[model samples]
Target: MNQLQSLKKITTVVADTGDIKFIQKYQPKDATTNPTLILQAINLSCYQNLIISAIKYAKLKGGNHQKKIVNASEKISVLIGSEILKYIPGKISTEVDARLSFNKEECIKKANSIIKMYEEEGINRSKILIKLAATWECIAAAKELKKNNINCNLTLLFSFAQARACAEAKVFLISPFVGRIYDWYKSKNPNEIYSVKKDPGVLSVRKIYKYYKENNYKTIIMGASFRRIEQILALAGCDYLTISPVLLKELENSLGVVDQILNNEKKYYKNNQSLSESEFRWHHNQDAMAVEKLSEGIRKFAKDQENLERILSKNF
Candidate 1:
């Protein structure tokens, strides 16, 4: 078997794209999308009908111009996510506005709205994973959403504290950004030639995987945003790894031994403590890489979101 086929044997491979063609090609168990991806996908000819549908949806919904555009943006994302679900058996993570990351009430409101939209399309809530930024407020919103049976995927997760808080809040999944973390460390020490085993991003995911398993946190560790196949190979046995089509295509052709680097078996023991908001902030602050990357990721997503809104606005 090719490395992609072999890797799927141990890890749940999730397609990290908004494009239906790639998701259909890879046949990943699950699929995920962000504002950037959705924006990119909507421009393609294949999704033109979805855009037209969203424009009509916004017009019929009948709101002020800004409200109509916001509604249209949400509709486009849900429309794309619903289209994705037609091909994949597992859940599709539709993100709340990244602009709402810091607001607890708005986060919860937007999540419920997204879930409601999916339900209106005859997609059950069980098949949808509400994707949110891993801010303290988003985590808090997720905690409440969980009580109402809305599963969440906390993305842009960069620190141990973020993982701990999300798990304690009983989130369904947390995506640790492996590639971005690797990028940060590489930028700092550009001269150092880092091996796959010693890769900062791989090491970060390993640490999170070990901690979650050792503590028996039901929350899953999905190592996401990988830069190279080695990083994905190193995280072979993670709960899930959302890979882009580029890497997925590379893995499909490459022949190599894919080792299981992480396992559910817990070899070490330590007391796991829940973090208060202050503690979460302080601990996350201590890691400069995590802090910088998390902020940058959010800003990037937010900017893409605005770009998407502009597209929808033009349609109306």
Candidate 2:
């Protein structure tokens, strides 16, 4: 069997692209899209209809209301999410504006707004996962949203402190990026060679998995941002692994025996109960790689959102 087929026996695979073509082919249980992927897809000929429809819908009700135009952006966001949901048997994660990462109130407000938009289209709340950066404020916002039965997928997680806070907050899921962590370490040490199983990125997610399993935290750990196929194989039995189209194809074409690399039934690490805000900040600060990558990821997402707004501005 191909590795992708083998992987399904052990892990819940998720597509990490806004491109519906790939999601259709791989047929992941879940799919995730960000401003970067959506914006890129919007410009393609295949998705042009979605853009035009979103603009027309915006102009009709908006009547030049700036809020409505921005709602056009949100409208397109929901429309795309709805389209992806048709193909996804599981939940589709739609991210809130990254600019509100540090503002708990604003994050909660926007997440609710997005959820409301989805609900307006008759999409159930359970079918969606409101995504937010794993910042302290965002985690706080997610915690509050969970009370109302709204789930969340905390993105841009780098430090163990961030993961711990999400668990304590009782958030729905945490996506600890494997590729970014590996990239950070590889950049730091240019000469040393790394193995698949021993990869720093793989080890990071494994550490988080062991901690959560040992503590019996209910938050799902989805390994994401993988740079190599080896990294994905290294994390075989993780709760979920969000794979991009590029690597998804590679896995579908390659043949190998995939093992159950992670299992709560087998390994567990004793983790502390909870961390205060100060403690979270201090630990995050101490980790140089996490500090740099977390900031960089946020900046990139923010910039991509800004670019999407600029594109929407010209047409709508």
- Highest lDDT against the true fold, candidate: 1
Model 1: worst 10 consecutive residues (lDDT sum) = 266-275
Considering every candidate listed, which one attains the maximal TM-score?
Answer: 1
lDDT of 1 by residue, 63-117 (tens): 8999999999999899999999999999999999999999999999999999988
Model 2 RMSD in Å is 1.7
- C-alpha lDDT (0 to 100) for residue 306 of candidate 1: 97
What's the lDDT for all of these models? 0.92, 0.89
Candidate 2 ranges with C-alpha deviation above 4 Å: 60-66, 266-272
**What are the TM-scores, per candidate, against the unseen true structure?**
0.98, 0.96
* Candidate 2 per-residue C-alpha lDDT over 51-78 given as tens digits, one digit per residue, 9 for 90 to 100: 8887887787765656656777877888
TM-score of 2: 0.96
Error of 1 at 158 (Å): 0.8
> Among all windows of ten consecutive residues in candidate 2, which has the lowest summed lDDT?
265-274
